[model samples]
Target: MPTPPRVLTIAGSDSGGGAGIQADLKTMLALGVHGMSVIAAVTAQNSLGVQGYWELPPVAVRAQLDSVLSDIGTQAVKTGMLASTVLVETVAEVLADVTVPIIVDPVGVSKHGDSLLAPDALDAVRSVLLPLATVVTPNLWEVEQLTGIKVDEENRLRDAAEAVRALGPEWVLIKGGHLPGEPVDLLFDGTSEYRFAAARHDNRHTHGTGCTLASAIASHLALGSDVVEAVGRAKEYVTGAIEHGFPLGEGIGPVDHAWLQRR
Candidate 1:
């Protein structure tokens, strides 16, 4: 009777199920959207750290995208962890024709501090992928990687946001989770800027936060929420997720995806 909101994640696979495609799908489901995935790489990772990764061929990635977009028709698309420059370009090219909000999570590293994006792929992301993004969600490290701006203080957040917007994304959300004090994130849409603040949860199990935030934004955008509202809602969701985050392994565990269920 009603059309379900369709969302797609073109990203890597997390064998640990804490982040990557696993987190994207979980976040989409929590926000009442139909989730789909196109795996770009398969990672051997756990809470301890990333052990190894092998990227899928460009043809396989394209085939997955074509199959999904041809049938389900996505309302929004989110991308993360394009492991190589070739994969980055391939994803950008395939999604160029899709008329949906694109949430790009420039995943540069894992929660345990292992590199995700290759050194050579940075330029590809900056030149090819960012221009097509509806919203670019970058964590503090990613912002530094993309723009060479170090975010040390609150005022520096604006600088980071401005630097990211210069690359062509309609909006940029520079996550300030690494900054000291309350959890604060900066959102800039060229003309306007918004700051979203949440209580800094003292939890270490925050593995999937970036993936969850991007997918949550995609879900909200598909539901017709504006950039500011979508980001605000996404931040609130992530905050709650972090507050109830649980320990899964010896190292940092994952934010509880079933947080809403607990509440």
Candidate 2:
């Protein structure tokens, strides 16, 4: 058998196996990519929410990254919750020289309204992390936190995308999942823009959508799709996952990462 395209996720671990590194790996597998992970933090999270999280030391984070990049170079890299200022800065620096595409999911809050990022790390996320992203995927809340731009209406997604693009990401994806209407996402690279819209699944058990989407993009990118194509494919996969989301643990359950295979 031919070797699958390797995709690496540098993020936190979710004990719930619903989000963070677990979601990333699952998405990558669904997309037919070899998934690897360098865990930056570990969160005590479940269907209910994140109870607590502990970030690995900067040195340990760096070692794991170096261990991966030095031996098995990846075709794409995805980033999720980095928790602290030092971790954010260190991850950015370590990934700076990477030649592959970097898909950054600016995960700010959990599905159950828990804060995962440190308050002081906002500046590091803006100054250090955003600039290094090949594609930055931020939800409405993350957009406001990172760029101070509020995306109230679907039409204003461009304004938010532009502001975020100015932060140095090659592409900016402003997610409109939280908006009133159908979930719409605006993808822009300053000169050109594309919009992807999907029927918002009414299922309230939609946890891990953000992490899954970004990882899907990385998986597609690793499989040789361009940024726009990757995002489009990812949207389709996530929409299906959301639609088929099953209830678990008496709270917001995770989207079915294996929805494709199960069908």
Candidate 3:
């Protein structure tokens, strides 16, 4: 037996097991990486929506980061809903000096349109957290939230990417899934640009798509893929997962993380 590449997720926990830390860990396992978690918040969430959430104390978050990084350091890191200004700052401070690849998924709301992040915390995410990222993945709504730029058309994805790049991340991935037609995501690092397009599955059960994609990217990075390659592979994996998505609760369901294994 050999040790697998390790990836850590710093995020909220969704009780429903569809998104947040749950999805991150599942995606890591599917991608053949060991997944570790540092829970920043806990949400009473299900397929219907988020009822409420509680943020852990800053000391607890710091302790969790130290406990993981000090003993079993990870090869890559991925972040999701931090929920508050202090939590965002706490995570940013700890991840500042980490040399491994970092993936930032600026989760603003749930699949059912429930707000997950505090409005006051947006500045900290743009200033402190995003700059420490090796790559920042923001969907259309998040892009508009972080940088006042709304991407309504596929052609405007570059504009949104550039706006986010100015915030200091080495790479920016603008997810155009909200736009009409097939989903097209643009990846840019100031100079080089790459676009990944996937067939849109006509399924309404895409609850954890964002979390799954970001975690898959982190997993591939931990497994020695470059940023471009990692994003490409992640896009493919998520497309399959979306295609195989199954209904869970009464509301939206989750993408199948083990879609590959099922086949």
lDDT of 3 at 183: 92
Q: Where in model 2 is the C-alpha error above 4 Å?
A: none
lDDT of each prediction vs. the true structure?
0.93, 0.93, 0.96
**Model 2 agreement with the true structure over 84-182: per-residue lDDT tens digits:** 999999999988899889999988889888998998999999899888899999999999988888888998999999999998899999899999988
Question: Candidate 1 lDDT, tens digit per residue, 1-263?
Answer: 79779999999999999999999999999888899999999999988999999999999999999999988889999999999999999999988999899999999999888999999999999999999999999998999999999998888999999999999999999999888888789999988999999998888899899999999999999988988899999999989999998998789899988899778
Model 2 Cα RMSD, 1 decimal: 0.8
How does candidate 2 score on lDDT?
Answer: 0.93
TM-score of each candidate? 0.98, 0.98, 0.99
**Collision count for each candidate, in order:** 0, 0, 0
Lowest lDDT 10-residue stretch of candidate 1: 177-186
> 30-110, model 3: which lDDT tens digit per residue?
999999999999999888999999999999999999999999999999999999999999999999989999999999999
Worst 10 residues of 2 by lDDT: 199-208
Candidate 2, TM-score vs. the true structure?
Answer: 0.98
| lDDT of candidate model 3 versus the reference | 0.96
